[model samples]
Target: MTRSEVPSGGPGADEYDVIVIGAGPVGENVAERAHASGLSALVVENELVGGECSYWACMPSKALLRPVTALADARRVAGAAQAVGGTLDASAVLERRDGFTGNWQDKGQVGWLESVGLDLLRGRARLDGPRRVVVETHDGTTRTLTARHAVAVCTGSRAALPGIPGIEDARPWTSRDATSAKEVPGRLAVVGGGVVGVEMATAWQALGSEVTLLVRGERLLPRMEPFAGELVAEALTAAGVAVRTGVSVEELNRPAADRPLTLSLSDGGRLECDEVLFATGRAPRTDDFGLETVGCEPGSWLSVDDTLRVTGVRGGWLYAVGDVNGRALLTHQGKYQARVAGAAIAARAAGVPLLETDRWGAHAATADHDAVPQVVFSDPEATSVGLTADEAERRGLRVRAVDVELGEVAGASLYADGYRGRARMVVDLDRGVVVGVTFVGAGVGELLHSATVAVAGEVPLERLWHAVPAYPTISEVWLRLLEAYRG
Candidate 1:
């Protein structure tokens, strides 16, 4: 039946097998998976159905960075360097980014929901009680929704601004403003050194902004290997970004909306910029929405089991997926959780037992712990899968780390002249299998999946040695790492 023809609960209410709050990618996946399992589903969204990734975070940011990366790649090659003449056309780049975001429209996403036989409700949803939700629609009307089987919360997260004095009045930019701004600031000061800070610094600097990157920590991208941050910092410096470390904003001052911002640094230094971005961190978007009514904290990240069912909630009928649950906040991982949660919900409703204890079970999101792959799209891209060497050591695993320079590899040299990159493979000594892998360089993002497979599949060293990498490719780094491990 068409979504419109679906039977309603009553005059001002509706009922479905699954009610997914937040029509972002995670929620959409949950509803689709549940529907595919023969359960009726309804999705409620307050903003665009595609959420932050489509409008402000992933798609638009990547769209803005691709041109910068392409130009940098061409300039690295000899013949191509001669052909490259001018700076990037900022206007054209912005237009391309706009195209990727579909100008912030969600019609296409809404249609996809209908095609998949999932109903859409445009409103802000709050948990009323077990299996019950109250929605505040844009038109100021209220409607109650009841889930017969499960209620999934996929509300995701929002940018968290720090509590520095005067920060509230300074009107600084969050990640959303950084990616979706209509006009680029002449002088941009970025606070924080995580993925968001570095990526936005790279994009805005290339797009004609004099970017000053301020990091409260000792180095940038501190979550990765030290060398990863070192290489990216070196590249950003060469590209004219003023990378500052061991500093933070003590205070901020702006006399008027048109005036530039004055920042007081903890290091007893003062600076002025046309704009400042606080990419400090993200907080779960669970401030309201009546979580307290369901015995969950109003603004706390939801804790969930492997099957994505919320812990401590009475009936195990409430699930939390995506950033709201704070498990590997990447989009792909959240969708993975969504699929697992949907299937588990459907199986439980049908009185079917789940392989809950099995790590590799179809309804378990085991990859969230053992193997999570991530790529930082900055120049000298950083990618890693599974555990970091430090992480493995902290977990008390007996492991050996093997390192290789990408410039020494034939394929890497051919890929770019004087290719400056590093690769590290951490092998679990007891199991003789790869537990972690890190690659930092230009175009290394594409090489991540092989490492992901190796770590996740627990492929042994001997077996990996026979899995030959094709000649003249970055994949050769795998062979070098293995040989180094043997030596």
Candidate 2:
């Protein structure tokens, strides 16, 4: 067998052209890209192969939100609003969510891996050394595997809880627990007010939970445009959510006996809720990955360049993609980086000219730097692409922000009756090009990609005019934005 095909050592001694740690969507994409480029790949995964998105974060969360969003959309229409009475079918919502999550199984993902000539090792893998990985199989057996070309670390991040007294004992729900929860608590207390907090709050509140949203900042969605948070908070409050901002839980304790979770707030107050969620943030899943062997710190996000090759390594044999790299944490962005990293590895192995200088090359993850898009699937969904106006100003760019009331657009009225939203365009005035765009509405998530393409492609304002948006569609909001920008 070729060196690439030979196992490194042991009973299941098998080697590969590429060894990818973590079998999440990012890892799967990396393996697929490498295999498509004629490389033998092996994916090491301890949990499900499709990673957190397929079961927990993206898939299940979206599944839970879609029903609620649909109901909200229906309620917004005059004709449909009459028929929309009563809460969601919580049991059916859970069942549908389970189906979307594949019942927490990875059978389909495994079959796809095998079909693509990529092998799977059900184990937790650690870096033994450069281009070498040691995997502890499910049966407690250890196998040493080596990659001939590259070893990619696509292990994603995990939810990070805050440092609060008695918090551990409190058993607060993380994103995983929140997304996969079958039963919605009658009273839910969500902490952090970020994407997870808001989205889960929206989901459970619609699913019949008395949701109390706690935000340490003054507003929800602190990272997005300010108005986005304001509109969402307004809607959430209107929907009976107790939206409390500038708040933090001091101490949390779940009683040993059958009692609700008691939380001590920073304002010298107390809250007792059936369940609490800590949607604070995410930390890289590298605390035990043997990063020290490669002269890197364990438990920290790996550093990588535009090509996603782990920086400061002796050879470009190491790559850290997805959430592990800390470039862009979104699933789609991680998959994009995986594609770039995979193609780079394949080209490097074949001794071909790398697309080093090409801005939009297959090897470079440029979009990760310039054009990452995000959609918050809340009622009056918030979508943004590229840099926000604040981000542009922080970067010291000469940017002009054009704000337009989305309600002014005929399409917004037609999309759903009484649709109130805002759209903003951040323009690089010197370059006369769109640098960023943000939209807040009932169904603006689908409109984000066009903005992404506009910013990513660096399509000038003049050229974008020719790409006319269809009338009487939410997309025509683009024309209003352009008009606002021109003025």
Candidate 3:
């Protein structure tokens, strides 16, 4: 039972019923569920017990964006706009962000693990064989452990940079560097127009950075409604962000490690900037999980069934959840899969009859098929759940997409002086239920879960019509959308 000065979790035995690799939120939940089922569980982690979302990705990113969003909200109000002047206090904002991240500390997470009675082993874990894992401890000691029931792989992903010349040597910032950056760069060139790119661009621009957003796509937030990107780009341009669309990077040259690099673009353009950020995509962290030992590819995303149990293996003892499974990349979606996978593991261990996990079952990740929610916390805030009209049509569902300007909502005009936004509700004509919902505007994030409930519960349009919204709130937009659908 090796423990750190920072206090690690439980110490039951070298062997346990279940061993989860990568002590992220998903892994913790898996161990928790197994423990609740009277099965001894342990987690093997190489870094901080809390995963990327806790320290680097979600927590820090949201912390940095909150002040910017709040001030923007204040600026849009009539009386409140009078009090607002000048830019945000960068020092205060960074300090608050630091506090939110716990200064890269993991004591709180470690304490939570201890409370849950889940054992933690600080080591790099990999599969040795069926129901077996080999862990290399921090101090250069290797130990082999046996799992009686299941072994779950919750190792998430890392920022995947593009395969361009001089990209690696350029040492550009990824999401981790963007979230934990101590000082805002003077001139920042953001590559890729995904959530990380736009959100970080918004944050740094607000915190006093000359931002150049380079997007290979035709517009920003390409995954959302087209107008969502149009509105966000308008707001960003108004705020003085250089949003260059339909552009590609030809090459990057940084002569000095500490100095700005000259950016070469495919459009015969050049810009020198203090920092460059690559928010391109993510790659699974399965390169060294010893998947080869179990006849699985080491560096590839693990394939899993509805229950999150690894499919290609001989026995169903191996499971992959979260980003590693390549299902959905969002933290909330990963956590959702974690809950379902954990319940499945517990049921299989106790020899109890597993619940029907076909679509929306106890052990199934049905939301991954549809009803996945996402929010990009840029200036105007774009949020959505389930499918868009195009997506429903692609899946062969006869659907009607009803669109309405958010300013028409009584609460939106009352909330902000000039609230420029849009809302779309995709209704399945055959099913008479809302299949997808999208909202873009100030404070639309709060209205997202209501849509999630509607889509996940398959709530009929008739039922939703009776759910009266408050007198003056953004939620009143739902009434307008439903009315548009009826018309």
lDDT of each: 0.91, 0.89, 0.90
What are the RMSDs of all candidates, in order?
1.7, 2.5, 1.9
Q: Give residue 186's lDDT in candidate 2 (0 to 100).
A: 85
| Residue 168 accuracy (lDDT) in model 1 | 82
TM-score of 1: 0.98
Poorest stretch of ten by lDDT in candidate 2: 1-10
Which residue pairs of candidate 2 clash? 7-13, 7-14, 7-15
Which ranges of candidate 1 are over 4 A from the true structure?
1-13
**How many clashing pairs does model 2 include?**
3
List, residue by residue over 1-487, the lDDT tens digit for candidate 3.
Answer: 3242212222635678999998888888888888888988888899988899998989889999999998999988988999998889998999998888789888888888888788888888889999999888886778788899999999999999888888877889999999999998999999988899999999999999999999999999988878889999999999999999999888888998987898899899888999999999999999878999999987999999999999989979999989999989988998898889889999998898886787898988999989999999998999999998888999999999999999989999988987889999999999999999999999999999999999999999999999999989989998999888888
* Tens-digit lDDT string for candidate 2 (1-487): 2222224355645677899999999999998999899988888889998999999899999999999999989988898999989989999999999998889988888877777777788888899888899988886778888889999999999999878998877788999999998788989999988888889999999999999998889988877889999999999999889999988999998877456889999999999999999999899999889999998998999999888998988878999999998888999999999888888888999999895737887778999878999999999899889998999999989999999888888889998888899999899988888989999988899999999989998889988888889988888888888887777
Clash count for each candidate, listed in order shown: 0, 3, 0
Best by lDDT: 1
Could you arrange the candidates by lDDT from highest to lowest?
A: 1, 3, 2
Tens digits of per-residue lDDT for model 1 on 353-455? 9956488788889999999999999998999888889989999999898999999999989888889999999999999999999999999999999999999
Superposed model 3: Cα runs more than 4 Å off: 1-12
